[model samples]
Target: MNFDASLWLIFILIGLATTLPRASFIVLGSRVALPLVLQRALRYAPAAALAAIVAPDVLVAGGQVEILNPKLAAAGVAVATASLWRNPWLPFIAGMGALHAVRYLSGS
Candidate 1:
């Protein structure tokens, strides 16, 4: 398949847009230290980002909050597993197991 010039230009622009900001941080971080408050705050960034990415998909279905969904049940199980076990892998295993169990029981 052949691509047109505009498509290639758009792809190049998107690649640069995605790469530049993150690259800038790494390049600049070697010389400049982040503020103490900012560094402390940034510690929560990964969890916050993970929640942001995962919450909607887990909670929402057909444009509504799906209280009875298997995903919701699985999320609860995952959280509980993480809290109790404090193991990263346990949460994932429990969540997937819960999801499959719910789906199988519900026949969906």
Candidate 2:
């Protein structure tokens, strides 16, 4: 196939790849069900996903693992805020605030 056709094919494949899995449950209806333990375990999927995304940026600074960094310190503060208050927004606000405060203080 030509370049344009190849791109279109790839795009369609990606669209189907993402769409099919998500639509499967609805398509399959209630006939199929996950195990109880698996269902319960999926509840933490979002948090686990978020951590998987954020942990790298927070832990790695200057392309290396550093014990002290604004991001790391901010993450700590954010975790503390999350544990203290159940409010979801509080942790985000606290984290960003801590990040900026530490960056400013440390002249980073």
Best by TM-score: 2
lDDT, residue 54, candidate 2: 90
Residue range 1-108, candidate 1, lDDT tens digits? 887789989999999987986787697877877699988997898899999999999999889998999999999999899889967799999999999999999999
**Number of clashes found in candidate 1:** 0
Candidate 1 TM-score to native: 0.64
lDDT string for model 2 (3-108, tens) is: 8668989999999988997898899999999799988998898899898999898999989988799999999998899999999899999999999999999997
Per-prediction TM-score to the true structure, in the order listed: 0.64, 0.65
Best by lDDT: 2
Model 2 score (lDDT):
0.91
lDDT over C-alpha atoms for residue 108 of model 2: 77
